[model samples]
Target: MDNQVEKKKKTNPFLTYFKDLGTAIAKGDVSVKLSMLFMGAGYTFHKQVIKGILVTLIEIAFIIMCIFYAAPNLAKFGTLGTVQFEQVLDPLTLQTTVNDYDNSFTILLNSIIALFLIVCFILFWISNMKSVYRLQVLDNEPESLTKKHINTFREDVRSLFSEKFHLTLLSLPALGVILMNIIPIFVLIAIAFTNYDQAHMPPNALFTWVGVSNFKSLFANSLTVTFGYAFRKILGWTLLWAVLATLTTFIFGILLAMLINSKTTKLPKMWRTLFIVAIAVPQFVTLLLVRYFFGDTGIVNSICSNIGVTEFLKSVGLVSQHLNYIPFLSSEHWAKFMIVMINIWVGVPYQMLIATGVLMNIPSDQIESAKIDGATNFQAFIHITMPYILFIQGPSLITDFVKNINNFNVIYLLTNNAFITPDQKLANSNAKEVDLLVTWLFRLTNDYYNYKMASVIGIIVFVICAVFTILSFTRMISGDREGDYQ
Candidate 1:
């Protein structure tokens, strides 16, 4: 019996249980445990359990405040002249007096919002408490007792915080994105549900919740003013302008860069510097200058009058000289065309600079080999240079396309608000005949004071940008590496 006891002691049941428990704890799934944590399914942390009780107490306090203190006093404030001048405190209990405007919608809405936030906080707190309890239970459970080794939660927390610095640096930009773009955008979206139009301006004229009425009235087929035409027209123009601007700028800029970089071209540096000057000058100044040139009394028309086109066409009896005095800035068709052309002028220089860089980087051996094979300059460019440049600059081109979409400075400065008239009846409020959605949104907020509509338009613009940004990010992150080939 003594010999048997000694042998069994080496293979003890307590030791066996501990080995099993350690294996189970080591192999436990974090995702499964995390799910259990949020659902209040198991106890994990002592601190969280304590916090949960505190939050429950706060919820009770908020309820009491709303019922006994807020609701009754609000009712009295709504009424006229029962010692209305004296501010009431706990009117239901007739406890004390407080202010006359205590029952204002502002106060009521604020209370509702605060209550909503408190409820959210309570829910989150409860979830965290449950998670903590589950984690704690897992940590405390012994290998000897439970037949599994428990993993310490602190190790996991420590590892998470100690992750690589490059990964952690991403949090700063992520936080910036949430604050700058997300918060303002969400606030604007919430504004769309309110009656915060020109009439019910805030501070003085309080805008209240109007629900989906604004959306229905604007978009529903039953409405008298079908904004469909205005929306369609503006959208059509925006798309047409974007396509034309991108293609023309790309084609001409590449052509010009290739031309100046060719061996046959003289004084390449001088010509390059000349183009660079255009890019260096502030765009607004150039656009404003260009706007003056297209004005009724501008230099372009004066030069045309001096040239034979105006008088020559008149002499051949093709048209009257009055056609020469056409308002380039005021006319819709003319303004749109002129803006596109002016964009090409202002845009091409920057593109030229980019193209030149890409062009210079192209392997000379590739070009020489193409030439040795008896390929023309155009063919060499098509096969060797063009592909190389495009591969290198595909991301830049995509960015340029996006820039063209929201290119407001040139359009706005060149045309001013002359083209866009204030038509409150329109969805975008007399968005210029040629105005992009962005400029129109600006006018709505700045000119008409229609913040609600402006916010809606802002949301639309955000959606468009977000879609493009996602596409660009996916392409760049997942696409072929240009530098790898080089």
Candidate 2:
């Protein structure tokens, strides 16, 4: 019997689906067959007046939608329309006439909507057929009409508010997610497969599906070689920045928290308050201030000049005598270093606060035992505190890394006005040495209107972030070593 069950479980899914479907069709009563054809015939035949009416109304609405929207859009979805707007002489008035063109945007949008509706309709049709078969089976069980109809409705309503209450509460949010999140994601994925760039943009120009060409173009052609190079450089920097920023901020934040929590530390609150003040100020304002302070003629350079640091550097050949100002934000390497250092400063406070909370939760017994074992403060931290913190903050660290990969505001706000010589820019790409993939995507869309390239970059960024996050979570969960020390 166990062997037979195992064989059955190994049977092909499609074969099982077909066998079940055939059985449902063959055993269904006449009303069930009619309901399969008309959507509400079984309910009406069973005298389920309200349910039958609602089902029938849904069928009518679906038919109306197919006629008015789905049919036309699905037809045009093939070519995305071929007609072009033209200017011609009007024979009647002997004047110039403009004829309407095929709007590819409308065609694509409507086709997507039609496809979504069709999927929904298919699901509803399946449910309707299944309900009809179930009702027929119930009918054969000799239930009273009141029990089948009125009592059934009452039971459904009661279940909705009781056993199925979560479903009822989630229905609106599910609908919102479908409309907003799911639809937009589908649209973005679809756009990545098309030539929907500046030259091929809407009504005036019709863009068609060029499946995988946009992706190929990113690495294949001379025109995009520069973009490919820029992508490689930016991606390298992004990974480096994420790792360095995450580690620097995390380490310093932990150390700061430890200092504040130390009995030997004086005026801990004052030190914490000073650090926390960075977080209290608006990030944009802070970034802007930092940018100016490090600019060529800004306070830092001015102070260096006033204190003769600039002259000293020139004498030592550290800076050229011809250039009187330090190019902190202007030079690529300098700008990158400054941005990372500034990020560490701005990001450490939040991590410090988190570390403070996490530190309190560490077992004092473990630390005291280590001390009694003649372990120094460093040894106690390395063995006990570090493991505890890592176990608790492992997932949070991964999240912070992902956030820093897409940390656009820091890079953009600080370097937006900083002058990068044209020689330093990517040959044909709208990317600077300091721009991350996210910042490059922003420049592509906002500055250059290169939607195709932007969409491709966006997809790549999402894939990279998703892969890292998934791998990190899998390691954290599957390793199951969180409580090993405990």
Candidate 3:
């Protein structure tokens, strides 16, 4: 049985598909066999001229797409473009003209699009062939002998509005995904295999496939450019930040909500409104204000100095001896600490609101039972409230963790120009002390124009995010744990 299973696994789907096609043609009537070459043959033979004409037109369109669109771009796909982009004297026209240059970027993009079209056409062709074979079978039936009884044009149109409305609804969205999401992803992957950096930029220069050289550079370390070193540091901090940011907000937010809901707390509504106001104000504006307040010469620094906090930090070796002001956003450890604190400040309010709704629905019976069993509020919360919330909010918690991994705003806004790396290796790799992977990708593409490496890093970031998201979601959905807690 295991041998049989192995044989089944080894069986190629493509081979089986073609084998079925060949058998259909061998056994089919003349029209079915001819449909292999002429898409309309079987339909026209059955007197469905309009349907046959549509199929024939589609076949002609495929041919035109291949000849006009796919061929020209694919022919240049290998080298991406031989001629440099420039104007020169035309030999035939005897006038200055632009050279027939291939843009590496455009050729690369168009070739991918053409390839996508061909793949889609191939699937359609296979389905078309199967359809024609089915027509052949129907033609053999006595009831279908007089004429083809395919759906009428009106029926087809009406079905699209009624029974098949989902197709109508999703067609435009599917097209948008292909154009805006899928094709650009393929283009990014394709460019990762080539030399598409500032030094080899298109229009002025041509880039060709370098074949994993960028990937090698990204992983391999050198004296001049320590990519591997920077990757390790940034990745470490990214994970640390993600974990801290996610957990701090989550745990603290629950506590805050509980405190607000407590009977002993005074003016709970007013306190809640103040926290809500913090969230209501724009997040970037808050971050920018925080950034200015924490600047070296800002008012906060003056307050810290007047309050003797700077001297206390100097005694503890946090503030530099030469500097009178606290380098809250300038020093590496200090900046990282401040970013986490500020992120907690920004994120906790939102978390508290979410937790508020969840805490209101904490299964009153469970809490009452914990109280009856002589459990204190802390014990009851530990055993009941937290578990109930976790059961209800597990998926959201997983998403929050994943979101924090790519959390660009807090890291970027807090650290961009505020913190500069003292590490030579990080600076060599065009990285700073507090750069997250997403922010690093931005700097690489937007500032440095090191797109090749950026693409590689982009891919890495995607992989990391995807892995965490998938694993967390998979574990969350794997079993009936929700039954135990909720």
Best by lDDT: 3
TM-score, each model? 0.67, 0.88, 0.89
- How many clashing residue pairs appear in each of the predictions shown? 18, 0, 0
Candidate 1's C-alpha runs over 4 A off are 1-175, 211-213, 216-226, 311-324, 417-428, 480-486
369-442, model 3: which lDDT tens digit per residue?
A: 87998999889888888888988888888789889988988988888888888888899889997998889989
* CA lDDT scores, all candidates in order: 0.66, 0.84, 0.87
Where is model 2 more than 4 Å wrong at Cα?
Answer: 1-23, 86-98, 143-155, 221-225, 266-273, 312-322, 419-421, 424-427, 475-486
- Model 2, range 301-383, lDDT digits (tens) per residue? 99999999889988987676798977788877768788889998899899999999999999999899889999999999999
lDDT for each residue of candidate 1 in 240-343, tens digit (9 for 90 to 100)? 77779988899899999988988899999999899889868898888888888878668886887787555775676543446765457776776877888888
**Winning model by TM-score:** 3
Candidate 2 versus the native: TM-score? 0.88
